[model samples]
Target: MRLLLKNTKLLQTKEQLQTCDVLIENNRIIAIKTDVESTTADQIIDCRGNLLVPGFIDVHVHLREPGGEHKETIETGTKAAARGGFTTICAMPNTNPVPDSIDRVENLHEKITADAKVRVLPYASITTGLQGETLSPITELAKQNVFAFTDDGVGIQTADQMLSAMRLAAKAGKAIVAHCEDNSLLHGGVVHQGLASERLNLPGISSVTEAVQIARDVLLAEAANCRYHVCHVSTKESVRVIRDAKRAGIKVTAEVTPHHLLLNEEDIKDADANFKMNPPLRSEADQEALLEGLLDGTIDMIATDHAPHATEEKALGFLKAPFGIVGLETAFPLLYTNLVKTKKVSLRQLIDWLTIKPAEAFQLPYGTMEIGKLADLTLIDLNSSEKIDKQKFYSKGKNTPFEGWKVFGIPKLTVMEGKIVYNNL
Candidate 1:
């Protein structure tokens, strides 16, 4: 089959936007030029000056399947990713079965093969059952094609345990993705250890909890020569550690979530659960450092740590509620409207963070608009504006903090392997 995307705008560079037509045959882009009107087969889409770019990629997301199905599933999560212009997403391994063994990894793969609407790369837990007491079968699970090993949702407690995992992962040629948190320093905190926590009279989560762990792990990673990745980085101290590590030639990469980039502790005016998240919204100084990291290449990519919980669970309020919010359906619009439109970040750089940078960090094959590349694409109407309505989301989780916020850059269509997965055109 052949598919034609006519009159779409492509960002060829930071300052250059080109108008062109793209032609795809089967699952590969066959031609891209001024006109592909003469080439015809299955169908054609008139993009009408919309932006056609490589599909977005999210390196960090929680699908909550095989264990937390009531919150989300492979089918529903990928559908939400499609609507958000993501053609690929990596699933965190904080599920019921944990996917620590080859058998368990195979079981998760079966679910993805049968139910996923977009590419779903699953991670195997770094430690057995994510207990942090012992390492999982890292070498064996790596051979099974797990994307990476992570003990997400909780940090590996000891430096010895993390070093051992990193050594095994380095030998296995796999990345060791970490959730940096020091339980000893948490102090039973629920929100950031700042003015918000003081004003709300809630226990505070200190920035030291995250930064101290990262500082230790980077040294361990350097010693073990492992590809280490940090998840949902939110603090200036954490950014300083990561930046210093990168400067010192440590093999490290990190991701900052959209929530961290756009929102801060000051936004938490009340006890609303929607604003709650792990590595909670921090001070404005921290937010500024995160942006600086992204701009200077210290931060590698932008990922939506898209965690979803039941509405009733979140209704418990910030103190007792879960630490997460749904992000897959709102990342693009929120960033584009708040950052790009506000001139804080250029459109080209934003696209790179969402698409190519994540792919490069993880070594994925998607996220480029070139002839002969796989036809995974997204068409977005940059001129259109709409209010973010949680009720209209395809995700089973509607716990976004951006609810009712006006935004632009709505995705009109998402195509994976030359097949339409989402269409609002």
Candidate 2:
């Protein structure tokens, strides 16, 4: 099958946008030029002079399948990802049967093959059952083609256990993706230890809970010589730690969520559960640091940390509700409106954070636009504007904090492997 995308703007460099036409045959991009006339194709799309770029990739997301299907299934989660202009997403291994074994990994793969609407890369848990006491079968699971090892829902408790897991992951040639939170310092906190928590009269989660573990893990990763990736980085100290580690050549990379970059503890004026999340929204100072880190190459990419929960669960109020908010459907628009449109970050930089940066950090082969590359792309209408309505979301979870916010840069179409997965044009 041949698919043609006409009159699309392509980013030629960090500062250059070139209007061009892209032609795809089967799943590969076949041609890209200023114009292609009189070409025969099974399908043709006039992009209306919109931006056409490589599809966004999220390295951290929770598709609660195999057990928590009431929240999200592989099919629903991936459809949400497609709607968000993501062609690829990494599934966190925090499901019921936890993908800690090769058998579990294979089982999850079967579900993904049967139901996924877009590319889904599954992660293997670093600790068996995510208990953080015994290590998972890293060497065996690595051979099963899992993307990486991470006990994402919880932090590895002990330095010895983390070091051991890092050693095995290094030998197995897989990255150790960490959720850095020291439980001892948690103090049963729900929101960040700041003005919001104090005013709301709630227990507070300190930034040290995240930074201290990061400080320890970077040393362990250096000793094990393993590729280390920090997930949903939300603190200024965490950014400082990751920045210093990269400068010291510790083989470390980190990702910030759109919420972390856009919202902060100050935004949580009430007891709204939608604002609740692991490593909860931090202070504005931390938010500024995260953006600085991204600009300076300290933060490698932007991921959604797209955790979903049932509507009732999120409605339980902040203290009783679970720690998560759905993100897969609103990520691009939120970032584009708040960061790009406001000139805090350029459009090209935002695209790189969503597309090439995550791919490069994970060593994946799906984040470039060129002849012969896979035709996984997104066409975005930068001039379009609308309010984010949760009722129209494809995701099962409607827990986004950006609900009803006006935003631009809506995705018009998403093509994955030469097939149109989403179209709003």
Candidate 3:
């Protein structure tokens, strides 16, 4: 099938914009120009005053398949991703049986191929069983096309173990995605260590809880000379550590979540479990610092860290509730409504953070809309106004803190590989 996307403004990079027409033939873009006479094509879409940008890519997502299907599945997750303007999403491997073996990786790929409306890339576990005792079949997993190695639910906990994993990952030519949390320092904490936690009288986790691990892991990556990507960076100190490390010429990369960028601990005063997430929201100062980091290029990408869970699971009290809120469905509008529309960031910068930056970090090639590239594109109606409604979500998980919030700039249509996957009036 051929498709013509007529005159539209596009986010070409972090700060570039252009008005052009894009022609997509089958699964790749065939032509891109400022003007093209109406040629014979199967379909033509007029994107008036809308944005035609490369589809967004979420690097860290928890598709709770192979174990917690009640919370989410590849089909549901990817569908939600497509509606949110994502063409590709990399899954984290802290699942039920953990994706550590060749068979497991292949099984996930096959499942995704069968049902996913968008591209699904899986990251294999760093350790054999994510147990941190022995290494995973890194070389074998790499041969199977695993994009990265990570045990995202927790850190390696030991420097030697991390160093070994980094060395093997570097040799295998794969990126190592890390979840920076010090289990030794983490006690039975349920919320951020701040005035809100004190008022709520819940156990608190300090900012140092994340920053300390960031420092340790940066050193480990430098020593092993490996390409490392930090997952869900949440604190001011952690941002400083990442910034300084990058200045010192370390090959380290990091991402921030939409929640961390827009919300803080004060939001937890209502005892809303959806507001609760691991590396729990910090202070207002931390939020400001995170935004600063993203603006200054200290943070390389913006990921939802879209962790989903059942409403019943989250309905429990704050202390007993699991940490996380579903994000895939709301990431685009939330960011656009808060960051871009509010002028905290430019639309081009936000688009680049979600697209090319993520593709570059994963060493993939699906982030651009140039001719001959995969026809993975997202069409968004930036003027479409909407309010946050959790009941309308496609994912099995209903856990979210943004319920009832007023939002605008929603995605009206999403296309993957020249096929329309999702659309709404």
Instruction: Estimate the TM-score of every prediction.
Output: 0.99, 0.99, 0.96
| Collision count of model 2 | 0
Candidate 2: list runs displaced more than 4 Å: none
- Candidate 1: lDDT of 393? 88
Report the candidate with higher lDDT, 1 versus 3. 1
TM-score of 1: 0.99
Global Cα RMSD, each model: 0.9, 1.0, 1.7
**Pairs that collide, model 2:** none
How far does residue 65 in candidate 2 sit from its true spot (Å)? 0.3
Instruction: Identify the runs in model 3 with alpha carbons over 4 angstroms from their true place.
Output: 11-19, 34-39
Instruction: Quantify all predictions' global Cα lDDT against the true fold.
Output: 0.93, 0.93, 0.87
Worst 10 residues of 1 by lDDT: 34-43
Candidate that scores best on lDDT = 1
The digit string of per-residue lDDT tens for model 2 on 346-421 reads 9889999998998888889999988999999999988879999999988889898988999998998999999999
Regions more than 4 Å wrong, model 1: none
Write down the lDDT that model 3 would get. 0.87
